[model samples]
Target chain A: MEFFINRSYFLNKITNVSHAISPNSPNPSYSGILIFLHPDMIHLTAQDSTMAIVTEIHPGELNQLRIESTGHMIVDAKYLIEIIRHMGGKNIHVMTVGDNMIQVSDENSKFNLFTLELERFALPDIKRPENEIKISLKNIRTTVDQIAYATSEKDARTMLMGVNFRSDGKRIITAATDSYRMALNYIDGEFSQNFNVTVPVRALQEAARIFKNDDDIIQIFVNKRKIQFVSDRTLIQSTLYDGTFPDIAAVIPKNFKSMMELDASMIIPVIERGILFKDDGVAELRMNLSEKGIQIYSGASTIGNADQQVYEVFYQGEELRMAVNGEYLLQAIKALKTLGKVRIDFTGVITPFKVSDPENKDMTMLVVPMRSSY
Target chain B: MEFFINRSYFLNKITNVSHAISPNSPNPSYSGILIFLHPDMIHLTAQDSTMAIVTEIHPGELNQLRIESTGHMIVDAKYLIEIIRHMGGKNIHVMTVGDNMIQVSDENSKFNLFTLELERFALPDIKRPENEIKISLKNIRTTVDQIAYATSEKDARTMLMGVNFRSDGKRIITAATDSYRMALNYIDGEFSQNFNVTVPVRALQEAARIFKNDDDIIQIFVNKRKIQFVSDRTLIQSTLYDGTFPDIAAVIPKNFKSMMELDASMIIPVIERGILFKDDGVAELRMNLSEKGIQIYSGASTIGNADQQVYEVFYQGEELRMAVNGEYLLQAIKALKTLGKVRIDFTGVITPFKVSDPENKDMTMLVVPMRSSY
Candidate 1:
């Protein structure tokens, strides 16, 4: 392979692809980035055990590329990125030398890196049909943010570590749960077919990051064994798990004994202060609602006890009190901060409760209360 | 004990004193901050096994303190800081309620924290004499920055972990070394006594952080067992090490066979880039100096090799080459970056070399060469 390209432009491409390459992979070739030089563009591929990222860089007004010969090589991802990032030159010259080595040089520095054989690097085949669905980047990003945090980080159950995506020709519903709490987001769109799939939360997060600076919409194709996202110059593919997601509709509470409406900005600070003694989110906090006002309090016998009151709250029905995870409540409230006010419903002390944004009615968060001695 | 003070002003005092308290201390009382409420001011003290920091907050223009009674109590430093940091009120009210507990409340929140008995909290007695030397805060801060990085972190040689401060009734000299490299700084000041003491590098770092916004001059008192620093509203005391510091005069070379002068801005980037393949500073790089110019290069058999050259250099001697730690050379060069052009002297291939700032004659850094197989 032989090529001359802009130094900074090459660095940007390698950094994005390096995120998918795991440094601890058992196979040495999995840790290398596959580089293929063509007459018009250069293609790069990096992968881990279950995911692969491929991107192409073409000659444009801002990017300079000149290809002398067409060839391919696999270089170590970590070393290549480090060398390119620190080289102090505007243009870089790259050419394959003898004895399985490549020469990379700028104006003042030269690096000769050992490369692996092309036959050792293998990428799984992915099918990209022409009938793939096009979804707005904003909708996909919102779905990931609204549901990814609820996925389980504990590896006891592999099914809970993914977010379920379901479409019924008119609307798309995404839900995530780790048995204690569930987050659901509803996005309305047009589609030709109905489907349901569970994607790993990490894959969704990577897709969201890649779309942060892209165009308005992208194409998504889902199969029985894999899923792919196609943009202008990049394609991301990930393997899907074979399991059924839990039924979220049946678990959501239908009615509540009491409901309160208040601005999210008022109670956030109280909860933040009350959790200082919450023992790193392991301790439970009691939330009290009554004719007097709203109060949140937690205590540790050896450390301290904190009690805080919210000044204004609109209430109806009977007063109720329940113990909930302090950290989960804070996250649920902060997610609805964009809306002016939020509504919280209580069914019982041991039953699940719901928090909803008044303006964004398509989204709701359900949190299960913890049993408390108080 | 009872008092009402400004929340922000109270937080600043505890934050400064908390630096001396270690979270992993075996003694429970040592992890707590001592609070003594007086008629005129509130004094706070925190300490570990080797150092103690005591600071006072008075009723000044910016700070408002109202004391109802004079008493003392010790509370966990971590919990107190967290409560005060998140409270949403201008003035905080603190009072002892009952049963070894104190109630801290603002307008919206209240906290009851358990406290340790007054008799269990012990602070070592430090001596302060009438005859003491005064040093500028700027001088102390600069000295800490220049020498602290060279202190040894290994526990095998406890004496090398402290920086030696020596005085001759007119100037104070500070030096630190880890057996491989040494850094020395000389501060000229008016003094009335001569003394030498080795203080832990951690203590100096804490003192520098405390004086970041204090007055210009502070008094320093040294004795057989401890050293004390006194300002208008604070006093810092630290224990002295028993062993003597290493003699730096014997290691610094007096004559050199080769010398080179170059702008520090010209070579910093080259070294920074060359260290990319240096395996986190374990690998050594070769520096070639001659009438031709200056060049630095390093290589790993399995990875790659990097070679870079300096743009302009003024040399005086025969051609020579030596291997040295890349990280140490980079640090020594960066220390003199503010003085513009720097002069470097080499005695031989394996002998110690010196990097000095031409504008600042009182500071010098010496680094020893490593024996390489190249």
Candidate 2:
């Protein structure tokens, strides 16, 4: 495209879209960022088949723009980004000199890069989808933060790599699990249609980062194959996984024989101390409740052992003994927002237990106990 | 060993020595730091065969020490560093509990770790050589800063991976090269015996970091296989590379055909500007000197080019044209400590060139030119 703009303004716009460009894409054209120059603004688009990002830069007071011609071209994302960042100048002039080369220059430095054919680049069509849902930006970001980490990273189980979003008429629930532990976040919202969809955790993380500055509502368009999150100046589209998500709601335990309330920080250090030794894949938590307080002891035989931790808790049940993965317990403790106390439910030695912050009832974490061979 | 000391005090001492411990050592005990607690002070030592560091922590200020036990043990570096950092307490009590287990605890947390046998660790039997040389710490640190970056990192040529120290009757010169470029620094010092030795670059870096507090004088004990740098509280021992270092003095060009004097900052931006291009390994400098001022032009083919950077310079010869790697030129420019003009001497298009600040002759940089097919 034939355009002249400030170096930093153009650099920032290209960087935002460049995150979606992959160097080793099967389609050669997908390795470049599509640039469209109009009369008043320039648009940049980058996609790697799975995720796409589109950003528009409007000429402002600092970014004065002059458009001599309107054209479209795809330039290599990695080289172009590096060239612009290292080109030392405040104002840079960019123009399409010929059919294949783009010229970028300033007072002391200039760069001419070969451009790929625009027709070969895969720019996703942005027509309005049939199924559209509107949600609050804050709620989406918070829900993604809470559940995204629990999603399985391995591709052996395709469906487990995504977080499932289920919306009834009034409230929306988000759950993620790798078949080991599950994280659930519930938010209040209004939905015109009842729908359930699985969105990839990587895409959700990118959406959260792009939506950080946007305070307005985000409109989501979902079809059978793709989902698009659109704001005012930014649009992020991601492909949907073609697998059925496991029914994790049924796996969450609802009944407990005994429960205890203890400070989250107090229990976190105790678990960390205990993780030093036990090599059998299980960390035993022996809890003794007396009139004074609750004492939690965990030990590992092969590495060493740890003791000397006491936490104040409210418990009326008999002394309970359970063994679970220390990493799972640490994750559950970290998910609690408030540091006051965490209410942990114990269903038997083998059943799944739930951990939740006493002040907030909307979030719950469940961890399946490891079978102790000892 | 039994001791009660501040947690931060022990953590700092361990961290200083832990850099020398290598987890992939042939002997498993070498992966741990040796701890020797006597009645007066506790000494910690770690070695990876290439470099070794020893630090001592004395008793008294914070807590009363019960010297009921005196022994030596080797603890894993990674686990000990992590535990000491995460254990949140001012005073931590450490004692040898059983055969190979040590108990580390405070009021809130306790950790027991399995220690390796002290007999399995290889503590280098290093003694201070009879005939040794001593140099000011300030001079040694300055010499290291000047030449360490030019040391070759490739292990194929072991001798190039070290900085060669040449001491005559009155002066000590340090030089390093990676076959492409070389840096040499000459400093005035008193030596009892003239000798030349090569020390590993990594050991020099560690010595520089450890002696950052500017000790008065550092004693250097050099043997056939080892070199020891001794200070008041620290002893840094490193193995010497056996291969003979190349004679770098022969590569330095003693005479020049053309010379030019210009400000160091002027050439810095030009080199920075030339780095924007994908190709064009060497930045060409064409100087056209007439009755008017000098004009310097630098350009890259794939990237655009720049022209007409006029600077007032006194040229000693006819119009000169030369090209050098932009990175090498930038390095030479940065090594100039003074803010005034720098003198650059060129022999020919392919021969080596030298650059030095006009005020000081102690520091000089020699760069070999990259052959250009064109």
Q: List CA RMSD, all candidates.
A: 2.1, 3.7
For each candidate, the DockQ is: 0.80, 0.43
lDDT of 2 by residue, A177-235 (tens): 88778888777655577777888876777777676554668888887777888886888
Q: Tell me the TM-score of model 1.
A: 0.95
lDDT of 1 by residue, B114-135 (tens): 9976676786565574447777
The runs of at least 3 residues in candidate 2 whose Cα sits more than 4 Å from the true structure, single-residue gaps closed, are A155-157, A188-190, A212-214, A243-254, A276-302, A312-316, A337-340, B62-66, B132-140, B155-157, B187-191, B243-255, B259-273, B276-318, B335-343
Clashing pairs in 2: A277-A300, A278-A300
The docking category that best describes candidate 1 is medium
- State, as a TM-score between 0 and 1, how close model 2 is to the true structure: 0.89
Q: Model 2 residue A127 lDDT?
A: 64
Pairs that collide, model 1: none
Give lDDT tens digits, candidate 2, residues B1-374.
88788888778778888888776899888988898988788888999878889877766675344455678898888778777787777878889888998888988677888898788887766677655777778877876777777788786888888888877567788888887788888876666888788888777777777765565688888866788887767888898888778767657788888787877766666556554442535565544443344554555564444444444566675555555576776777786655679887878767887888878887778888767542
